[model samples]
Target: MARKISAPSLFQLGYYWEAKIFLTSVKLDLYTPLAKGPKTAKNLAGLIEADTDALTRLLDALVSIGLLRREGDAYANIPELAEFLAKTSRFYMGELMLLQDAEWDHWGKLEDIIKTGKPTVQDNIFMNTPELGATVSKVLHRMAKRVAPALAEKIDLSDYKTLIDVGGGGGAFTIAFCQRYPHIKASLFDLPQTLKVAQENIAQAQLNHRIELIEGNFNTGPLPGTYDVVFASDILHYQTEAENAALVKRLYDATEPGGFIIIKDMFIDDDENEPGWNAVFSIHMMVYSEKGRCFQGKKIRDWMTQAGFDNIVEIEKNTILAGTKGV
Candidate 1:
């Protein structure tokens, strides 16, 4: 008989063992079967090509982990996991799992990384080659495209004529916005190699006519002052606190008076203990970046105030931070 394992010690390890199981299920496309409706054990086994007995246990394990729900003789996808984990869902977060999987290999080297304080990206299989990075960037763009349009609804973006996506990987955000607001022209700022994928995504979205592509590192170069709204999503976590302040200042200068700067990223709670997701992401950043991690909204508000942006507002809880430059 196999000895039963206990829940991972929260203080000893940052990640729970169940996270590993969930990600494995995601990789195997196990969530897709239940996206449409619940499935019987035999049906799910056929879909996954696994033994029915093993598959039943697998489904039960998933349910225990809160990613799936089993009612009587039927098993169904949990709504949150169904929407985000299933590849068929529009808001699918499979790419986020890809990102996580890329980092998973490096978890073995966590001790070394902790002692050396260096990124394991190059050594890991997921980020070793430029081509792989580009591929991951494209996947990330698809994820962003799914997320941005939903945000456009509540915000008043009518006055803005141009949207500049800074470090905009894959240009999905720009594609979504341009498609929704036909009058708004879009510009994507990224390295040439990365922008190539963005160009392809734009063509896929059929927004090529309304978008312009610019190639350069925004960190080393001065931001051009023509855009009405400057946006950064899931990019700033790569920079240090001082770099974030400088970048915000640059965006403040680049925007015309009355224009807005929008930042979309995971925000830590004020006390830094809430939002378990944000806290876990901070650990992930420690593995990927030397100095960056999930930032607090208070810090973002302070950055806006210091950068001369007025009317700073936390845009709901979508991890969006927005502020307008003085008119």
Candidate 2:
């Protein structure tokens, strides 16, 4: 007799419950304390000021989800969680996780968005809220610190002297590039409030002299200055296709003859079928913004070519694309 196959697990709704639990843990600053060492439920409760029984249950759930580990009656963060989830760690992701926690409210309106085919809110609440904006900026800065080093290694900046990081939040890429190439000077273009956060980060990096913060809305006007390298990372998905094309034309004009233009974003395939994350993110854009959606890499490349870019290359498995303007 053939072995019976169990029905596929259909705990789809459980994902949100699990996420809520994880977010609650991060909100309470549980992982940071666990980073010190293993501790019992009572000890953790005292450290984070939570109810002992309640905290223990949450810890047990985290352990089941593989975020924490249990040995006997003590609980501790897993190695990966300790490094990235602990508030004290350099690459701490608590702020980003908290941002998601805040988004839970927005996400709750997804059913309505799907039905109405429109965003429930007119503007991004997080951007409108100053405190939330600052938190988001800090998270972006930390994420950039992680990605920038790899980006610097992949791209050659020896010949590039001046760079314009359009819509550059937190100035993480600029700081990383400037540190890697001592001769490079970068200007970070963003809104006034975001530039404030970027300024603080640049000062902290001690690259204040090298990275200049320029305040403007790139969506409405042309870039302020010409640059040897124009870089925009994770900015394209926030606009419609026509807007991105127009922006690419503007970026081309901002680029010096023979200069380079680099666009780093989550680009989907032409069919928009493969790369599951890109597809899901396309929906995320739909729910978040009125016109934003992930664009096809081929379409973006075609736009570059039409704008007089030459020798375009896709790197980092199509996440980063670069093209050079004719001299």
Candidate with the greatest TM-score versus the true structure: 2
RMSD (Å) of each candidate, 1 decimal: 6.2, 4.0
- Write one digit per residue (lDDT tens) for candidate 2, span 174-268: 88889889999999998777888899888998998998889887877789989999999988887878888888999999999989999999888
TM-score of each: 0.72, 0.88
Candidate 2 deviant stretches above 4 angstroms: 1-9, 12-15, 46-49
lDDT of 1 at 117: 78
lDDT of 2 at 228: 98
Model 1, span 202-266: residue lDDT tens: 88888888998988767775786557898888776767789888888887878878789888888
